[model samples]
Target: MLTRDEALTLVKRHVSEENNLKHMIAVGAVMKELAARLGEDPVKWEVVGILHDIDFERCTGLTDHTLIARELLKGVVDDEVVGAIMAHNWENTGVALDTRMKKALVASDAVSGLIVAAALVMPSKKLAEVKPESLIKKYKSKEFARGASRERMVISAEFGVPLEEFLTAALEGMKKVADELGL
Candidate 1:
């Protein structure tokens, strides 16, 4: 399995936008946390999270969102990792969410944006100040963090994680890297 350092290097090489990098890092953190809670390999899950959006800039639209990353990582990573990445974009990729890791990826991807968006609107603009209750409140408002799909976030249920618990876990995960996220 690829280490965090190597995965980060790959992410930096392919993704140049500042916010995009932060987004990927946020997802990576959440994935690592979720993996630990789910009794999976945190490192591998972190690598999958880090590399999931490596092709965002290169690929456009749902059909292509994960295609380039899939090709780029064809031989370097395991099929399961690639599948999880592709599975995150399953609506367009047509890949089945066959694994818990895949479901966690989909659940983690947009919820990170929701949590980050919540922090951005805070007076302190600090993740430390963002609470689970605040996330729950923000999640109820569709206007808040419009890009973050409520349906997608709710998919955490399929992973056997309560939506509240998943949000709390994701919030804590993002909090760990608040400095890197500049939140």
Candidate 2:
């Protein structure tokens, strides 16, 4: 049960992009929060999120995003974490069906991007300035936040959380360290 701090430190040793690193951290926080509420292992989920993009900055082209990460994390993290990381990369790893861990990873990965985009659009351009209603509107726009997958964000419904509620919770989780992330 590696802590999120351990995972972050390990990832930073291999990747250098500040923004990509921050995004990983933000997703880790959201995953930890969601895992806690879902009665899952927060540390494991957080580690999964933190290391999911360990090779994103290292991959040469767009085609093998998850492959690089998977290869890099091979002997480092636990197998379950690796699976969650791959599960989030549907384009590369294919959809991970009938698996709660995979579904949870997909949810955290997708929703975190939407929440961050909402923060970027805020007047203050800060995570604290983002609101739940704004997230919901963005979630349904389909045309908005073009890279965020609304379908992946559907995992929120599994826990009886409306998209807005899930967004708020996920945002709050990341905003806890907004200054650290510079977002």
Highest lDDT model number: 1
Instruction: Give the poorly placed runs of model 2, Cα more than 4 Å off.
Output: 158-162
> Where does candidate 1 have its weakest 10-residue lDDT segment?
56-65
lDDT of each: 0.92, 0.79
Indicate which candidate wins on TM-score.
1
Which tens-of-lDDT digit does each residue in 23-134 have in candidate 1? 9899999999998998989999988988999999899777798999989899989999999999998889999987899999998998998999999899999999999998
- For candidate 2, the 10 contiguous residues with the lowest summed lDDT are 92-101
Model 1 clash pairs? Answer: none
Against the hidden true structure, what lDDT does model 1 obtain? 0.92
